[model samples]
Target: MNVLDLLEQWKQSDTFNNTLSDDHQVISYQEAYLRISVYSDWLASNSFTQPMAFYCAQSIEHLLMLIALMFNEVNFVLLPVKSTDVDKELFADQLTLKPHFCDMLRHIQLTKQAQCKTVATPGRIYFKTSGSLGTPKLVVHQRHNLIANSRNVLTRLPLNASSRVLIPVPMHHMYGFGAALWPCLLVGASIHLTSNLNILRFKAVERQFAPTVAYLTPSTVGALLLRSCKSSQYEFIVSAGDCFDRQTFQQAQTKFGRVFNLYGSTELGVVAIGEIQSKGEAVDDCVTALPGVKIKIESEQIAVKHPFGFDFYLYQQTRDVFFNTGDLARGDEITGFSVIGRAKLSINREGRLIAFSELESQIKQHQHIQDVALVKGRKDSKGHTIVAIVESTTELAPDELRRQLGKFLPRYATPSKIIIEPQLPRLVSGKINRKQIALHYEETEF
Candidate 1:
């Protein structure tokens, strides 16, 4: 069913009696509907026609704005207000500018705005990858994709009526919106939306709500472990979108009980799910694919054709039959698949190819390494040197980290530059803005 159909179903179900809550307030679905109705009335009164962009700042308002837009059939973009290295011009000429948010919409002078395409049908949600890396283009999904993507998570995961989900991730991200938020909405389960994701706020969420499910990333889990969180019980924690360190997974499993690894991307919904019990996973490192999702290891890269595949492009307006996830992997449909690394991120050091993710993952295994990001360094007559930007507590010398790296990686796989930093800049989705980091070093150090 489409978003409108789902909304209508919820209106008729007991879900209307349930509540949607955040850090600050709690409102029933009925109340949310009324507020959305008022906002819808406001939009209609103002003749809102352009494809809007909402600076989704973790609140009930952000959630309601999405719902209201979906109902109003307004094409929109959700930009995280706090993401690092975000292109300020990512939405230029593509959206009705700010000052249109909240109360300012009525006051802003009308300008030539980009008009949204008049589609005869519903379920056209627009999403763009974190634009730090390249020219950000909108990845579009239709109604069936929305439902199928949500169901892929809902079916595999064990959320129930009693479950209370703690969402520290932003709703703009597919990991957060599709996998985390959609299931809660579909199941009529309780959700506590946090204004920000941090150790203090995370503890506060647990202390206040006693939530059963948590949507987290590798970096957030690392932050929690670094803060020495108490061993807690959770139904399951889904980790996605980045290279989750094996050690961090063990620590998270110890702290949160069961940690489930969900593999997917913004272009495609979740491809697989696996439970981690210890430091070492299965030899194949298998993760079962969702029903109707066909996965193939074409030339060692994971390619998937699923119902949730982004059907249309907001700008290009074309459809891709299959999404070739640039990730490298090995497995059959029966054996499932394991992500090796991203094809584009592979570096050639002295003509010996080294997958950057493998190098970064190896470095992250260091006891002192809290977080690590890999970027290509200077190129001369020699070869392209791999750089490792590391986040650690104690002072680190390049030589020492190199020595540590020698223990795990081969000579060629060892990073050429070891820059110690207090922290690496990351997108709101928790993946390191590698393109930004590479560009920064290219300008300064190279």
Candidate 2:
């Protein structure tokens, strides 16, 4: 259903009383709709045809403006909720956006105007892909794509009017918007959106409104698990990002009842939902595909096609019927499928191509290592070399890490350089900033 229809249906039913709480205040569905309408009316009057990018204010108003724009011209790009100048210049050649959107306060101030009502203008929503292997690209989708994808999630997950979801991820990212916001809004479920995620802040939220489902990243999950909160109201723990190793997954399932590692891309909303297995069931990283979604391995890359999947990538100049998610995956009848790594992250060393993420996963198996990131260093005469940056819970030596990885991976996949650090850098969406890490080690020698 369309957003307006969804909101109207909720208003007509008992769901209108359901709450949408942020860090500061709590408001009911009807209350939020009134606020959103005020912003949307302003957008509908200002005419625009070209796609425009946005900077996040990280408030209830940002969401209101997005909902408002969706009701109007529909074509707007969300630059990954990060405060960067690149987002400002993305549509520079195409659209003229007056009054740059900086990080203001809770509400967005749009100069209001009145124009004659027009037909509902529908357009695409472009989200920035995680720039793990290379430069980030935009994934173009529509409101229907988001609605269909959220419906798929709602169909799979046990969510209803009574469900309360915790949304810690940024609203600008597809994971937070498509996975958290749309599903919660469409299903008439309440959401507890936190401005900050920490021991004191989250504990406060838990005391006020007990969250049923937590859609968080592995990093956030790790931090949350360490907290001494006396609450156990979490029924489902949803996580994405490559950092979800077997150890993290099992620990989450132990604490929270059911933990599902959502395997998805911004291009294809959510392809599979792998129930993070317990201690040992011969963990195979098997993720079951959603209905009506087709998956295949072309040139060893995971290719997907679904109704919810977007067709073109405007920035990359890629137009395809099947979105070839440069991710490397393996599937069979028994094991289903497993997403291993990205095709762009593969390092060709001595004619053997090794996925950096796959190699990093193998290294993370070493008990002492807390986190790992693999980056491609400068190419010497032998070829491109791999660098492993380790974040260990306990003390770890580089030589010992290599000795451990030698048992799990081949020599070609082994990191030529190991940099020890207290923590690994991450993007807003919880994906490793492999782009940044790669640039860091690129200037150094092995």
Candidate 3:
């Protein structure tokens, strides 16, 4: 069903009084609908003939604006308010949104020069990647596919009318907008949007809202472990965007309720999610693909065939039957797949290929190493030298780290050099900035 069909269903649901809240205030779905109706009416009067870039802030008003836009069938590109200059340059015309959002729409103005194509049908949404791995481009998903993606996630995950979901990630992201928020909207679940969340803020919101479900990233999970927060029993929690060590996962399971590892991307909405566990069942490392989504491993790289995948990248007509994710995986469809590393980042060491993600995973197993990134440093007659940048729980010598790693890794597999840093740079999605790190240390002497 499309977004409009979902909205009609929500209007007739018994849980119409379910609330959507943030730090500012709480509003029921009833009030939200009234605001959306008024805003959509205003949008109809002041129609935007060309595609405009939209700044989506983490607030209830922004959510309302999104719903209104979908209903009005306005073609727009979604971007975070704190977007970079490069992002703004992609779209010359902008749609400015303000506080008390609907009232400001009456005077909303669009600048000249449209860069994006306007779809004949409504419900087109574009989300760009963080460019952590490579150049960021706009990934387009039809409105119906987005709703279907949410349904696919719900089939694996459990959310109901009584469920209360706490979302700390930016709504502009697919992880938040598709996997989390859209699912809540479909099920009539309450949503609490937390902005600029930290350890202290997380604790405060927890005490106040008592959310039954939460959508978190690995970085947020790391923060909780660092703060030594108490165990919080909830329906379930889903973590994604990056991989963490087994130790971190076990520690998180102890502190929080059952934690599930979710694997998804911008092109394909919610590809796979951890299998649901019965009461008293242990959590598994394998994640099963959602219904109708096919997963295959080719040349150690993961490939996906998602029925509800995006149409295509903006200004590019390349669409493959099986999208090569560029990520390494090892598992059959029956057993489920586990993401190992990036296929493109593999480096040659003495004629032997090594996936740095596997190296980083092994390094993370060390008690002191909280996080680590293995990047290709330089190439010579010998081979490409591997450099390891580590974030540790305590001060540790680089020589000592190499010695510790040597016990498990072969002499050739050991990192040629190790750099100890307290904090490593990460993108908004919690993935390490390997591209940035590689560019920064490209000229370092091996």
Candidate 4:
């Protein structure tokens, strides 16, 4: 069913409660239903259609715009709030979708002239990657696929009329859509939206909303643990979009009590989830697969089969139904599985292939290294440098670290330069901001 039908049903039911606060405003089932209906009506009066581009920041307006589009069975391209002019132009040219800039506080009448013609009707939502790994690709997901995937996630953490879901990530990203927003909407749970990552704001939101659960990234969870907060503030925390380090996991457990790690990507939603007891232990086997979704490993690459998995881009030439996620994974009969690392990040230096994740794991083993990212840099006089951008707690000479890596890695694989920074810049999802790091190194003398 379309999102509007669900909303209409919930609005008439007694389960609707429209209580939300400025600090901790949560959309009750009823309020969410009413708001979505109002927005849908407004969009219908205006000329809104499927396959449009939504360009806006993370706010109530953003959420409402998405809901309106979904209600109308419109497929939208989510333009990141920080998108550059180049990004917008390229997206428009490629997708052939017209842009919709949201103005929430004001009601502006939209006309049919504003609507963009649909280029392709894959009957799915499209999301763009960060383009850090390479050029950004549009990932297509069916509405039913999302609903099915969300049902699987709900099996792990059931939602109901009494449940409140705190959304820390932007709705555009798959993590935000699958984990926080869609799941709540599916089960009549309250949704509390917060764009700020400030610890005080998080604490205040939790205290005021009393949300039963929340979705967070590793970096956000770490930051929350570092701050002063009561353990009883949250029942459970779900981490996704990036790996959760051991220290951060422990710190969160100490602060918030329960933490769960989610694994998936834009191509595949909610592949697996496990309770993180400590970072050192293997990720638990407990995982719930969405209905009609199947997982398998073909030559170490995580491959997925589902009715909804579509092309990397709407304009792309290739059309492979099964997605081959470039991730190494392992599974046992009893424990299920866990993703080891990305296949693209694996490097070949001096005739030896070394996984970037392995290199990162080794570097993070250092007591002073809080976080590190290893990327292949331009070939220098001493072969390809495994450049390491490190977030360090204490001073560590680059020469010394290079010497340490040489013992395990080949001489050629040893990092030629170790750029120490106070903190690693991260994407909104809290993954290492590789694009920013590349820019940083470009400006540096080394």
Candidate 5:
């Protein structure tokens, strides 16, 4: 269903009283739609003939403006940075939304209009991929397709008007926007959004909002487990953006009753979700593809063709029928498939290819280690050396870690050098920032 139809359905429902909230304030669906109506009217009055870029933090105002922009059929790009931080010269062609306070309609301001070839299409939504591996690029999606992707999520985890969702991730990211927010809105669920959530803040929010569902990252799950908060069980919880090791998955399932691992990419919206195993069974990593989505393991890399996948990257119109997601996977559609690691990040060692994700998972098994990240170092006679940076509960000498890894891993698979730290660098989505880690250890001798 389109957003307008969804909103109309919400208006006729008993849960029109259900609320959407941010750290700033709480407003019912009635109030939210009223504000959106006002914003839409104002946006319609203004004749916007050019493409625009919107850069705002995750707030109710940001969401209202986004809906209003779409409502008025004004094509715009959703930037990942705040307006104040954006480089005006770089995006001079497209109009830009000026920074504003809470008032969405009154505070609307746009930069001087100019031609922008990248965002020529009207009635489209745009997002930028997190440049963890390289430079960030704009990803474009059809507005209707985005809604369709959200519907795919419902095939697995259904929501209701009574559902209360806690979203701590940034709305600019696809995980938060497409997977969580749109689905919640479609079901008229009570929503509460927060930023930079830690265990203490999480507990406080839980008590205040009484959230029945949450969108979380692996690191956030680790923090909740670390605190041993005895958090109340909910309908279900979703963990995505990166893979979760077996131990974390088991602990989360025990604590949360039902924890689902979502396997998707910025390109393909909600591809598949890990199937829920029967009670008392070990948690499985294998995920089944969502409705109308095709998945194949070609040359060990995951290839996807989703009805709701993004159209193309900015300035790059040509696209393959089946997008080759750089992630490696094994298994099939019937039994389900397991996403292993990034295809580009796999390292060759002594005629053997080792996935860094598998290597880190093995290193995390060490009793002293809390987390691990593998970085590809300079090539040696045997192969490219691997640098292992570990976050440990207690201080572990480099020699001691090597000795412990030697017991489980083959000699070629063990890290050539080890760096012990209090914590490993991570993105907000909980994926390791390998580029940052490599830059930090560039000068060190192995």
Candidate 6:
């Protein structure tokens, strides 16, 4: 079903709260629906109909603009407001669409150009990855794929009409769009969008709204844990986009109880959800895949098949209909299945290859190591050197840690350099900032 149809359903529902907070500054579902209608009406007055670029910050106007685009049956690209002017210009040129800036003055001038498309045929939604790996490539998804994935995720999390959900992540990212926005829209759950990721702000909103569930990233979860907030406020806490480390999970459980760790990517919707137990053990891996969705592992790489799948672009051509995720996973009866690491990041020393996650999992077992990220450093005339950037609480001599790792991993697999740091840099999604860490080594005196 089209997302706009869901908005229509929400408009009719009286049980859900359309507004949140004492400020009453936040838009209610009813208010959002009306704004969407108004925006659609504005678009219809003009003749512009093709896909447009949506560049807006986190606000009521931004949310309504997105819903209006969906309702008007227009395919629009969601661009992060954090992007530079050059980046925005380049993106608009690449997509062959006019840029719609959401500032007060710009909004008035651009409304005339925001022509609504009258086509009844459903269009595709596009999201770009962080340009860390080359230029950020655009990933396309059909309406059906999004709806199916949303339905599949809801089946596992079990959100209903009465459920109040908090969306802490940015809507531009697929994790935020699929996990927070789409699920709430489809299930008719009340959505609470925070302007920013501040612990005090989030807690205050929680006390006021009392949402049953919250969609968050590992970094945001880490912040919540650092503050030692009460987790009993939310019944279900779902984390995605990055790995939920044991320390973060344990701290969260201390306050909030249990949280469901979800695994997926922008290319391959929601793949699995594992219940992380109190003892820091992933209890199950048998994620309930959506109907018509099949998982296959070829050469240790996980691939997915679905009737409604992403139409990825490769070398200027629309590649395969099926998505072969570059992630590595192993299927088993006990844990069911688990993602070990990304294929691109796996290190191969000489002829012997080893998964980065395997090394990380092994090193994390060590009491001294607070957190660690395994990466391929530099190759000498001999071979490639496996490097481990570790976040440690105390001084654990690199030599001593190297000896410890030797007990489990082979000499070649052990990281040649164990660089100790006060803390590890991480992306918004909670993945290690490898590029930033690599730069640190390059610029350091030692």
Which model scores highest in TM-score?
A: 5
* Order by TM-score, highest first: 5, 3, 2, 1, 4, 6
The better candidate by TM-score, 2 or 4, is: 2
Q: Write the per-residue lDDT of candidate 5 for residues 1-446, one digit (tens) a residue.
A: 44478678797666789988887778888888878888787776766545577775667777777877766667777775543333343343343343343454445556665644443567777777755222466787888898889988988886788889999877778888888988888788999988888888888788888888988876577677764644565777887755555666767766676778788877888899974454344445678999999888877788898999999986788899889988888888666888776777666554345777767777888889889888887765445788888887676678888888988877988888888888888999998777898788743545
Error of 3 at 49 (Å): 3.6
Q: Give the Cα lDDT of each candidate.
A: 0.68, 0.68, 0.75, 0.63, 0.75, 0.64
- Worst lDDT run of 10 residues, candidate 2, spans 92-101
Please give the lDDT score at residue 363 for candidate 2: 81
lDDT of 4 by residue, 1-446 (tens): 77755766556544567443233234455555566677777666654344556664556545766766666766667767565532333222221112232346254333233334345363567788644322467776677767777767777665665666688777777778877777777666667777776778876786777777788876567666655646665677787644555556667777666777777777776776777665346334234345566777777677777554545565675755667777777773135556656677665443234667656776777777889987767643223457888897666677786677677654655677787778899999989988777676742534
For residue 440, give model 3's deviation from the true position in Å: 19
lDDT of prediction 6: 0.64
What are the models' TM-scores? 0.69, 0.70, 0.73, 0.69, 0.74, 0.68
Q: Which is better, 4 or 5, measured by lDDT?
A: 5
- TM-score of structure candidate 4: 0.69
Better of 3 and 4 by TM-score: 3
Query: Residue 250's C-alpha lDDT in candidate 5?
Result: 69
Question: Residues 236-278, candidate 6, lDDT per residue (tens digit)?
Answer: 7787544555666777667665677776767766766766565
lDDT for residue 295 in candidate 1, whole number 0-100: 83
Compared with the true structure, what per-residue lDDT tens digits does model 2 show for residues 227-340? 443346878878776535565566676677787777777788888777766546445556877878877776668777778877567655566677777777777423567776
